[model samples]
Target: MPQPLIRRAGSADADVLTAVGAETFVETFGHLYPETDLRRYLAEAYALDRTRADLADPAKASWIVEADGEVIGYALAGPCALPHPEVTPDCGELKRIYLRRAWQGGGLGARLFGETMAWLQARGPRTVWLGVWSENHGAQRFYARHGFEKAGEYDFHVGDTVDREYILTRPPVSFSTVTTKTALDEHNLA
Candidate 1:
C-alpha cells in the first residue's frame, strides 16, 4: 500500500475537498437523503468557489489526506458553539470528516481522524464537536470509537420535512480517558 500523505490543505486543494465531500457524503448517506437533495447539498456545500473561500478563511483550518499525490480524504476543523456552553468561548468543531470509499478501510480513516484531532487539540480547544445525521449509524459508531459521545441534543430543520442531527464531542481533557479505556478493553479481550 502506498503511504498516505497528511498535510494542511492549501488553496489548490479546496475544489478537490469540496468535490470529495459531496461524493463521499452521497455514497455514505444516499439511503437517507434523496438523490436530488444529496446532489443539491453537495453542489452547494462543496462548490469550488465556496470551498476556496472557506479554505482562505483565517479562522478555519482544513486538511487533505492524500495517497500517491491524489486527495483521498479531508478533514475540516473550526470554532463552533454547540453541545452545552460550547465547552469554551474558543471551542472548535470537527466540521467535516470524510474519506473516499476506496480509502474507508485500510486504516486510513483512523489515521485521518487522529491527525485531525491532533491538529485541533494543539490549538488548545476546550472541546471538539461535530454533528452527524441521525441515520448515519456507521459514522456515529466511528466517532464513538474515537471517544465522541452524543450530547443528548438534536438540531432540527423545517424543510419539506424535519431533519435532525446529533451533536457529539471529544473534550481535550478526555484524551487520557479514551486512551486508558482502549488499553483496558484490549487487555480484557486478550
Candidate 2:
C-alpha cells in the first residue's frame, strides 16, 4: 500500500471525521456495550455539528490519515479537560485517537501520536494527559512506553455504561530530554 496521507483536519472535513470516528469507535469497543447504548453514544459523540465546531476551535487540533482516498484514522488534541484536579487550562489532552482495526500495529498510530504530541508541546512544555480504558492493556503499555504514567482513575461514560478509565500524564520535559527521534525509537517505529 502507498503511504497514507496525514494532514491537519479542518471544519470542512467534519463529515468524514464523524463517519471515521463512529466507525473506529464501534470497531474497537462495540462488543462491550448493548446496541441501544452504543447507538446513543455514537449519536452524541460523533455528531457532525459537534465535530465541525471542534475542528473550528483554535485551541484544539486534529489530524486525519487517509489512504486511497478514504480516512482510516484520526487523532484529536486540546486543552486539558480530564477530571484530574491537577489538570489546568495550560495542560494538553489527547482527547481521541483511533484507527480502523486493519490499520493498527503498523507504526501509523505512533506517527499520528507523535504529530499530536508535537502540536501539544508546540507552545512550550506543559503536562500532557490522556484517558484510556483500564482494561486496554496494550494501549496502557503503549502510553507508558511514551513516558506517560497512570496518575489517577475516572469513569468514562458511553451512554449508560461506565468504563473504568485510567488518567495518564506525561510531565513537562525539556525539549532536549525527549526528541521526536527518541519518541519513535521508544516505539521502535523509527
Candidate 3:
C-alpha cells in the first residue's frame, strides 16, 4: 500500500475532489438530509466544474491527502465568506477539512488542520474562522483543541435544513505589534 501523501491540488484533481468531497459529505452528514436534497447540494457544492474553478482560482487553495492511491482527506482555505460582523475584512477562513471515517482518530485530522492553518497564516490573515455544526461535539472539540473559540452563531443552510452553526475563530499568528484606530480613543482623551 502506498503511504499517505499530502499535496496541493491542481486543476487535474477536480474529478478526484468532486468524488471525495461528495462521498465524505454523505458519509459524515448524509443522515441529516434527504436524498434529493443531498444530491442537489452535492451537485452544487462538489461539482467537477466548480471544483476545477476553485482549483484555478488564485484566491483559494485546496489540498489533497492520498493514501494507497486513494484520496483519504482534503482541506481548503481562502478569504472569509461568512458574514459575521466581528470578522475583519481581510480575515481568512478554513473552509473545509473532510476525511474519510476510516482515516480519522489516527492523528490525520491534526496534521491536515495544521497544514491548512499554516496556509491561512501565510496569507497574512490575523484571524481565521470556521463554521461547525452545533451538535457535532467531536468536531467542536477538534477545533477547540486548535485554539479556536466561539466567536458567534449563524444559520447554515444544509439542504433546506437550517442548522444552527457556531462560528469559531482563532488568530493565525501573533505579530510583534498590532495597530488599531486608537485615534478615537486618543481624541476622547482630549
Lowest lDDT block of 10, candidate 1: 154-163
Per-residue lDDT of model 3, residues 1-190, tens digit only: 5557888999889889989999998999999988887888888989888898889988889999999888999998888888699777679898999999998876666667767776776646478899999999999987775678998999987678788999999875642111121222223333
- Model 3: what TM-score? 0.87
User: Which 10 consecutive residues of model 3 have the lowest summed lDDT?
Assistant: 176-185
Per-residue CA lDDT of model 2 for 87-139, tens digit only, reads 99899999999999998887888878878888888878889999999999999
- Sorted by TM-score (best first), the order is 2, 3, 1
C-alpha root-mean-square deviation, candidate 2? 1.6
How many residue pairs clash in model 3?
0
Which of the two candidates, 1 or 2, achieves a greater lDDT against the reference? 2
What's the true lDDT of residue 152 in model 2?
97
Residues 19-63 of candidate 1: C-alpha lDDT, one tens digit per residue: 777777767665676656666666666788888987898777898
lDDT for position 157 in model 2: 91
> lDDT of candidate 3?
0.80
C-alpha TM-score for every candidate: 0.80, 0.94, 0.87
Question: How many clashing residue pairs appear in each of the predictions shown?
Answer: 0, 0, 0
